[model samples]
Target: MGMNYFHQLLCRSSRWERASATQIVPWALKGLDLGDNALEVGPGYGANVATLRTRVPALTGLEIDPALAARLRTRKFDQLRVIEGDATAMPLPDTEFSSVVSFTMLHHVPTPALQDDLFAEAFRVLRPGGVFAGSDGLDRPTFRLIHLGDTCVPVPPATMTARLTRAGFTDVEVHSAATYFRFRARRPA
Candidate 1:
């Protein structure tokens, strides 16, 4: 499927709505010291952005979809900036953010290599002792059907922890539940 079509499908799907809900954001970010400022990669329609702002007063969102990014900018959340960019190659300074977070978006990166790149980029942007936290769907027939023809790499918790370690993150932790996996890794100080 095309990128635009996938984006449209995500926006229309009730499942997507439930998965990207603000309530879930807190759970994904739990226990991490996000500090004062944070960055969210691939915040689909800015659902996580709204909740993240409640925790970290200063937040920036990197969205791959230009249209969605434009729409998010219209909301004009205080201390929130929406930048349209690729997750693997963010257009921001190094060690600028206190934390980096993503919610159920890594599978959309098309390949494991790209996903690793995303992890590295998150590490590159975060300050020393900062956190990189997120959650992603587990590999399952039902979850595979949800993506259908689209690109989805259901990364397991173990694999995710390895990738985080390879990407130069420390204190990696990956927790697996029934349908999804949540992870947290720290950049060394």
Candidate 2:
């Protein structure tokens, strides 16, 4: 199975386990303020939601695959609501959330237009002054060897900032380390 398929399998498992401390959602969420009524796109194995909801009381996840959404619903995470939908064309209303986030999913979105659409949707859903933060694997040999879901577009931090700017997000910032890229963007109040 592909890396994406493996992630789906992990979601189906009863107990969630991450591959590393770095990959754990709690560590990723540290020092970040994910506002209330948050939306997480492609939540992968629902691990991030498990941690994110601790900080944001009303957290929802939009997963493209219905099966994954079903599995997540069964998990019964207290602050989590799972919906089956695509990020590029989200099903929710505009300005509905205080925050929007994604984890390790942008690179797999296929085309640049789709990527922009995903960001646009994120922007549309977020209230002014809200934030978006995520960790994505960069397109590099080591990352490719381990995580085939790494972006085909090689989203450098600058490129992500530019994209966020075009999507009406301001104060975009990126922090790169090892094989991953972390970014935070804010909607203007």
RMSD to native for every prediction?
Answer: 2.4, 3.1
> Which candidate wins on lDDT?
1
The sequence of per-residue lDDT tens digits that candidate 2 reaches over residues 2-82 is: 255554455445554444223645544557787768898987567676567667888889988676678778875565888
Model 2, position 163: C-alpha lDDT score: 92
**Residue pair clashes in candidate 2:** none
Query: Which candidate gets the maximum TM-score versus the true structure?
Result: 1
The lDDT of each candidate is: 0.81, 0.75
For model 1, what is the C-alpha lDDT against the true structure? 0.81
What does candidate 1's lDDT look like per residue over 72-175, in tens digits?
Answer: 78865554888889989999999999999988788888778898999999999999999999888888988887676676776767887788999999999888
The per-candidate count of clashes, in order, stands at 0, 0
| TM, every model | 0.89, 0.84
TM-score of 1: 0.89
